[model samples]
Target: MVHSRVSINIDSWKKVSKANKDQIFKEIHHDYAVEDNIKKPLLKKLGKMHRDWRNRLRSGF
Candidate 1:
């Protein structure tokens, strides 16, 4: 059995205000923009696969 540990520094996070959270979200959104470009194509492919599966199920195949 493997155990994973999860620890959070609540005091440090509590020090962050709404402004800090907004700035962090802005930075994350910017980073996600880059990843989203790469992910878009993969997501489209997956969507197609999902549609195909749904169609097959509907057709009783």
Candidate 2:
């Protein structure tokens, strides 16, 4: 199967005005905090992965 690439150009922001930059930064920070909140459960799952891996290695899996 082939997958198409999706891309964003970060340097395009250089052409944006200062007011737009501030607004974008606020939105970015808001989204980041929301994302961190949403990822709490996934972070817990990651902790479990590490614990499971340790147990399997200890048991010579």
In angstroms, how far off is 7's CA in candidate 2? 34
Q: Pick the candidate with the highest TM-score.
A: 1
Compared with the true structure, all predictions reach lDDT values of: 0.56, 0.56
**Candidate 2 segments exceeding 4 Å error:** 1-36
lDDT of 1: 0.56
Structural similarity to truth (TM-score) of each candidate: 0.41, 0.40
lDDT of 1 at 49: 62
Model 1: lowest-lDDT 10 consecutive positions? 3-12
Worst 10 residues of 2 by lDDT: 3-12
lDDT of 1 by residue, 1-61 (tens): 7633332222344546978767755654455666766755654564566557758978999
Which stretches in model 1 have alpha-carbon errors above 4 Å? Answer: 1-34
lDDT of 2 by residue, 1-61 (tens): 7643322232354556878767755655455565666655544564466557758978999
